[model samples]
Target: MSSLPINPPPRLLMGPGPINADPRVLRAMSAQLIGQYDPAMTDYMTETQALYRQVWATTNEATLLVDGTSRAGIEAAIVSLVKPGDRVLVPVFGRFGHLLVEIAERAGADVHTIETEWGQVFPVSVIANAIARVKPRLLAVVYGDTATTMNQPLDELGEICARHGALFYTDATASLGGNDFAMDAWGLDAATAGLQKCLSGPSGSAPISLSERAVAVIRGRTKVEAGIALETDEASPDVIRSNYFDLGQILDYWGPRRLNHHTEATSMLYGARECARIILAEGRQAVIDRHALAGLAMLAGVQGLGLQVFGDVTHKMNNVVAVEIPAGIDGDRARAALLADFGVEIGTSFGPLAGRVWRIGTMGYNARKDAVLTTLAALENVLRRGGVRAGTSGAGVDAALEVYEG
Candidate 1:
């Protein structure tokens, strides 16, 4: 086999996630690596935490990065705060919601779930009623499920959880930077998100925030790693199940104590830090507005092409749109043609929506007028080639252009 230096072809990623990384983030990742314990590295870690505080819109002192992907952050939050036999309430509106239930169950929680149909989001009243009945220790849900492109309303759910005496948690991996998220105002006890979606970075690090109440729960189950334990180190009777995902020890590493847990991933730290810097520099609200504008344009373009959208558009996320596969066209083949001919990529459905819908995203660095118009133009060409009559010639691009003009 022949080997060569990594040089991948240019691709316009219009998929639901892992969108193109911001060039600034890529450049940051290319910097020279430093020892994890070095003063410079520790300083970068602290600065990154501060930056993410602004991103999450919270003053939580427990905000930090989880070494692995976004799921690692979710696992850390669930396993550290949820103990065996504890009751957990999960509302499943999409695939990610089921993931929360699975992670909680694997951590030995007695998980109870309430589910809505694939395209619909749960109403605040229904979730409130479930909380009152289950009265679980924690209420875990997904803020945005890419599987459905639905943004679950979190503003009111926080108050509901507080009234019912339950810790509120959400996975904002798909919605954090691109959507309106107010952690403190919304009364979220804990939140976790990935960098790939709207943060404009690669998918290796997770930014997480924990309220004091959530921190207290994790502390109760804390256990000091034996390798770094002193004679006086205290271990909680109910130690967390996973060593690597333990928030208590991770906090120590990021906290003033500067204890060692796992070796920090330096390049990912650089990428994550730059991602936050980019968000704040652009103004978080402005970035979210950009995503909203792009999403609207994409929607209008698809509708102009005479394509019926999937799910409840009213609850759709600002970063992605789901369009129904037109009648008499092979959904996968069309997507394949778009990629092969136009160097563009979109997403396919999962589970129930499989073979029924296509997901196109406008997120992060790619959430712009140019990206939206290009993707719509490519899609229109592909559909027309497949014999699906779009309205008039160039209707899709014209429709998207109208959005930008307005």
Candidate 2:
């Protein structure tokens, strides 16, 4: 292949995730690389931990970054805390909930799940009743499932877990920073999130926080790596199976000890740190409010285009909206047209929702009035070109503008 400079097309990512990264985050990622053991790198790590504590609305000392995608954080939190033969209860509201089940099972957890319809969320009572019967060691669920655009209510579930003596874990990859999530206030034992969504950064780093209870469980399963092991270090039978995903080791690396783990992805650390810094500088709640406002505009815009919003609207996430594909247009075709003709990229659904709905996100750096209006205009034009029978000439844009102006 001939060598060519990498110049990509401009795309407004109005999709579920991996949205447009904030320019500041991009700049941060471009900074000069430094050794992992450098004082500057350690200081950046410490500052990142502090920033994420504010972002996650927690004061937990165990908050740190996992050097992988959001799922890596999920796996780390699961595998470290859950030993083989432990029972893990998962309430499946959408795709990510099933992901938790898969991860837990891989960790040798005896996973049991109660599932609701794809577009709906499980009520607290239902999960509580399941916990009552199953008496699981850990309760895992997704805070937001982008596939269905639903935000699972977790506030009450923590107390329910407390009542049942179960550890509470939530994968907040899709919802963190864009939606209302209080890790400490909600009594969450473990919570993991990615930088992509409302954090306005790439997906390489996962910011995770663990309550003391969760940390204690992970410590029990700690095994110092063979290469770094001291003569006095003892290995336990219940040690975490994966060295790479071991939270105990990761904690040591992130904590004051500064023990070497994997050579930290320096660029991703810069990006993650910058993401948290941007959120904190903007004020966490203010960013969430911005996402909420943008989401409402998108929702109204789609509705004005005479499209039906999917799922329970009250339970929908503040970052993405699912709209039913109009009767006469192809969902994928419309999305492709939006991308090719307008340089705007929307998302299609998964599992049961495939071919039935389109997922448009107003998240990260793209969660703004202009992005929402531009996407809505492009979508309406595409639908009309595809011979859709519903929307008027300026209906979508008007609706969205009204939201912004109101």
Candidate 3:
């Protein structure tokens, strides 16, 4: 076999996730590694947790990083809080919702799901009704499902869960930082997110936070390691199913105990720390406002090209938009042309929406007016080449500019 180098072409990522990380974050990741328990390393970890508390808008003491991808955070929260036979209500809106269902099921949760059409989100009353009926121990939901480009309304669900004595959880991988998420104000007991989305970092680390209530539940099922066991150490027979994903043990690593769990991913920790720092430095609301502006511009541009936007626009995420593919144009062909010619990447939908919609995102470091305009211009060229008619050559850019200018 021929030897190959690691060089990769640069492309503007305007997809659902894994977008370009902020340059500062990439730089931070390049710093030299240190021992897990080194004073400097532990200091970075503490700073990271404190930074994420602001990013997540929660004063939750258990906020910290999970060593794996965003899914690791999701699994840790689920497997730790949801013991075997616990009831979990998952409101399925898109592919990620199904993922929550699968994880909850594997955790031996009595999973119950209420779903709406792929392009739609559940109303508060609908979810409240499900909670009342299922009487679940946990209410797990996806704050933003990139597969549908729709953001489920979550403000009311928290109170509903509280009224029913259920713990509330959400996967914010696709929405956090780019959207208005108040974990504490919304009464979210547990929330998990990735750095790759609005946080503008790579996907190797997951930032998670838990309320005191969730910590209590996790602590109850905590188990001490056989090697580290002592007479005074507390252990539970119902230890978390996956040691790698035990949030209680992970908390010990993050908490004042500074207990050794796993050797943390140092570079990823640096990256995660910088991601949170950038967001906090920028002011969370200002960043969210930027995403809203970029998203609006993209939506207007697509509509100007005479394409129908998918989903209930009001409930759509402020970072990603789903555009229905115009008739007689192959969606993949258009996407390929945009990528090959302009080096801009948009996303495609999955499940029921596969091949039917093109998901375009304006998030993370790419959420900017110029990025939005350029993607629209590129998309218009690709669509036109594919024989899709628009009012004019510059219609997409013009419409987007109108939004930006306004």
Candidate 4:
């Protein structure tokens, strides 16, 4: 076997997530490793917590990273906060909502779900009604679901949950950084996100924030593993089921206690830190406005090609759009051509929307005028070649330019 250093080919990822990481983040991740508790490493960790607080728009002292993909954060929050037989309410708008339900069930919660059509979001009144009926201990929702390119509004849900004496949690994996999210202002008790989408980095790290109330729930269940237990350290009988996902122990690692939990993933930490740094540097609102403009341009360009946009436009996320594939074109074949011929990748839908719509994203590093225009041009060519009439030549690009020029 030949021993060769690794190299990867380049392609512009214009899909829902795990998009191109920001170059600055890559460079930071390339920095040499450091011991987990080295003063420098701890300082980096502290700074990372501070940076993610801004990213999450919170003052939570419990803000930190989970050493896995976005789903790790989701599971950690659920398994820790939700005890067996507790009532949990999930408002299912898309695929990720189903994920919350599944995780909560595995955590032994008595999970109840209220579902909307794939392309629709729940009215606040509908959710409030469910909370009234279910009387759940926790209400879990997704801020954005790439499956339908819809964003469920959470501005009022948190206050509703508080009034009902239930905790509020949301997975912001697809909407953070590139969209408007206010963890404190919106009264969210806990929230989690990934670097792959709006944060503009790879997917191995999950940034999460927990309000003091949520932290108390997890702290009540704290159980230091048997191997690491001290004589004075008391372990709770209501321990979190998953060893690696115990957030109480995780907080001790990130907190002033400096307790060891696990060997930190240094490279992913560096990348997550850099992602937040870049977004805060650009101004969070400005970065969101950039995604909004790019998303609008993409929507306009696809409409100019005579394609129908999916979902409720008003509730759509600012970073991605779902466009209905034309009647006679093979959606997969057209996607293949865009990848093979143009070296640009878009995303497909799941479940109910599988073959009916294509999800195109303008997020993170790829959310720019050039990227939007290039995808539009490439998509127009592919559609025409696939024997689907996609407006006059250059119409798609021209329409997108109008959005940028405006």
**What are the Cα lDDT values of the candidates?**
0.93, 0.92, 0.92, 0.93
Prediction-by-prediction clash tally: 0, 0, 0, 0
RMSD (CA, Å), each prediction: 1.7, 1.6, 1.8, 1.7
Tell how far residue 254 is off in model 3, in angstroms: 0.7
Global lDDT of model 3 = 0.92
> Local error of candidate 1 at 73, Å?
0.8
lDDT of 3 by residue, 201-262 (tens): 99989999999999999988776652254344344436677878988889988888887889
Please report, as a residue range, the 10-residue window in candidate 1 with the lowest summed lDDT: 226-235
* lDDT of candidate 1 at residue 394, scale 0 to 100: 91
Residues 1-406, candidate 1, lDDT per residue (tens digit)?
9899899888999999889999999999999999998899999999999999999999999999999999999999999989888899999999899899999999989999999999999999999999999999999999999999999999998888888889999999999999999999999999999999999999999999999999998876776653354344354336687889999999988999887888999999999999999999999999999999999999999999999998999999999999999999999899999999999999997899999899999999999899999999999899989999999999999999999999
What are the runs in model 3 whose C-alpha is more than 4 Å off? 225-237
TM-score of 1: 0.97
Report the C-alpha displacement of residue 338, candidate 2, in angstroms.
Answer: 0.7
For candidate 2, write residues 1-406 as lDDT tens digits.
Answer: 8999999899999999889999999999999999898999999999999999999999999999999999899999999999889999999988888899999999889999999999899988899999999999999999999999999999998898998899999999999999999998899999999999989999899999999999999877786643365444354448688889999999989989887788899999999999999998998989999999999999999999999999999999999999999897878878888999999998998899989999999998999999999998888888888998557798999998999899
Give the Cα error of residue 369 in candidate 3, in Å.
Answer: 1.2
List runs of model 2 lying over 4 Å from the truth.
225-237
Could you tell me the lDDT of residue 159 within candidate 4?
86
